[model samples]
Target: MDLQQRINAFVQLGTFLREISSESISKTSSSKFHNQIPQILQAAQNNNRWFTETNIKFAFASWGHALTETTINSWLSSYSITQKIPNTIAIIMAGNIPLVGFHDFLSVLMSGNKVLAKLSSNDNILLPFLVSFLVEQHSDFKESIQLTEKKVTNFDAVIATGSDNTARYFEYYFGKYPHIIRKNRNSVAVLTGKETEEQLLSLSDDIFQYFGLGCRNVSKLFIPKEYDFHPFFEAMFNKKEYINNHKYINNYDYNKAVYLMSNIKLLDNEFLLLKQDSGYSSPISVVFYETYEDLSELQTKFSEDKDRIQAIVGNSGIAGEIPFGKAQQPTLWDYADGVDTMKFLVEL
Candidate 1:
């Protein structure tokens, strides 16, 4: 199949996904993806506690809007997608968030390479369902896709996503192949104390979406000295329902107890905890915050440690910074770790 054919197939898949999301939620699914939603959602939830029906549907909605013809065309515009000898591109997915490695899969197929996906045990359900839809739309996809439970081998290149420790393992094993091995990274938001309540409310999505599991979810905040957090706390109240989840509550309670016993000062709202920390990766239900005096100095510091950051969320207008609420809604070109997956695949 040509690039246009692949794009058309994905567009069809996107439409099906969006329609099914609405219909399934309303108990009125007539579309192809509708009948399968229940089985997939149930399987996902059973495999991982974090994969609630709500989060799964949110993922569906995001991809449904993302995999459109316009977005696909725009993303591919800069590259020549041709296939003379299609290489096998193996993907090792991370299950922290649903369908996390799908962009790599899409990149490989769009560039006319075959995909050998080793599904993370934590994220076993979502991608395969979408892959089934793709195969149904274009039977040729069956030849281009492989889902394996065994160790990955016989691949021309590898794209693996994992934490820092696992990243070292990936490097040791897959170093010989053309690879994009990712490490632990987190997003951050900066506040100037001038943001409107609406903006802060939107920023709450950056912090709480996917229960703050995704790398793109903001885990840290930078605020001006002596900043008033009253408005920020009020804005984040929208996500107070997050406390209802036992896993999240357990983390909050445990972390809060640790801080209390250690006599570490913290700001708590009976749900979320804000601690004065310079770290970017915060525990669930806790947001680490640091005080910044100079915007230029902070920008410079972030630039030096760019690899550790996934997205910079704020209205600060820092170069390539993600807008207040857009940390989780990255475009096709928002390559993780600032590495272009499509470019890597095309070069491979």
Candidate 2:
């Protein structure tokens, strides 16, 4: 399909998602796939317990909002999306969160490349179904998108996301080809001890969303040394219902017990645990905090460790920091790992 055709297809898909998530379908554009959403939601939850309907729908809503014509055009305006000899771009998607690999998929397609996608077993359902809708929108897409479980082969380039261990494997296997290989990265929030109650409550979303599984979820905090835990804990109370998720609660209990056994001092609010740690990747249901005597010093540390961090959430006036509660709601231009996928693709 041509570039405009591709853009139009995605715009329609965006409309479909917005309608499906809101259950206010009033357009015939998505009629073919409209009835399939409920079944897809159930099947996704059944296949991956972490893919609760709420999170999946939230993902849908996020993508729906992002895929609008205005946003898409604005994002693409800087690029010269000229039709080129199509290259096959194979994607190794991560299943940590719903549609985590979608931006890569969109990048490859929008750059006029063929998609040979290896869907993560934990998240194999949703993207293909959406691709089906795209194919229906324009028959040309039927030849452009291929989802597979077998070892991917014969691609011009590769984009893979995984843990540090799997990233090594990806490098070994796909290193000969042009590639973008991403490893484990976590987001962190900076607390100045002056944030309003509203901001802290919003920060809770950065912590609890997706059960803290996604890379964008804040796992670490940089707080002033004398910062009180009272307001932070109280704000976290907003998401106390996370305890109702059996899987989440199991992690909390297990981590809490393990920490207690080690005699590690912890601040517990019954539902969440806070521990002093120098590490970035905290366990699910636990957030690591480190006291910062100077925000400027911490900023320098972040600069040195940028590769290990996916995002920084705060209003500390730090360059490139994401606002609290907006970690999961990245704009189209927010490249993961700070690598520009479209630039890489088009230049190839």
| Best-performing candidate as measured by lDDT | 2
**What's model 2's TM-score?**
0.98
Candidate 1 residue-wise lDDT at 322: 75
Clashes of each: 0, 0
Query: Which lDDT values do the candidates have, in the order given?
Result: 0.90, 0.93
- Angstrom error of the Cα, residue 145, model 2: value is 0.4
Model 1 alpha-carbon miss at residue 7, Å: 0.6
lDDT of 2 by residue, 214-267 (tens): 999999999997889999999999998999999999999999999999999999
RMSD of every candidate to native, in Å, equals: 1.2, 1.5
Question: For candidate 2, which ten residues in a row score worst on lDDT?
Answer: 23-32
Question: Which tens-of-lDDT digit does each residue in 1-348 have in candidate 1?
Answer: 988899999999888768766754536756556776788889899999999888888888888889899988998998987766999998999889989988898899999999999999999788888888999899999999999767988999999999999999999999999999999999999899999999999999999889999999999999999999999999999988988999889999999999999999999998999999988899998999999998899999899989899989898766667788888888889999999899888887
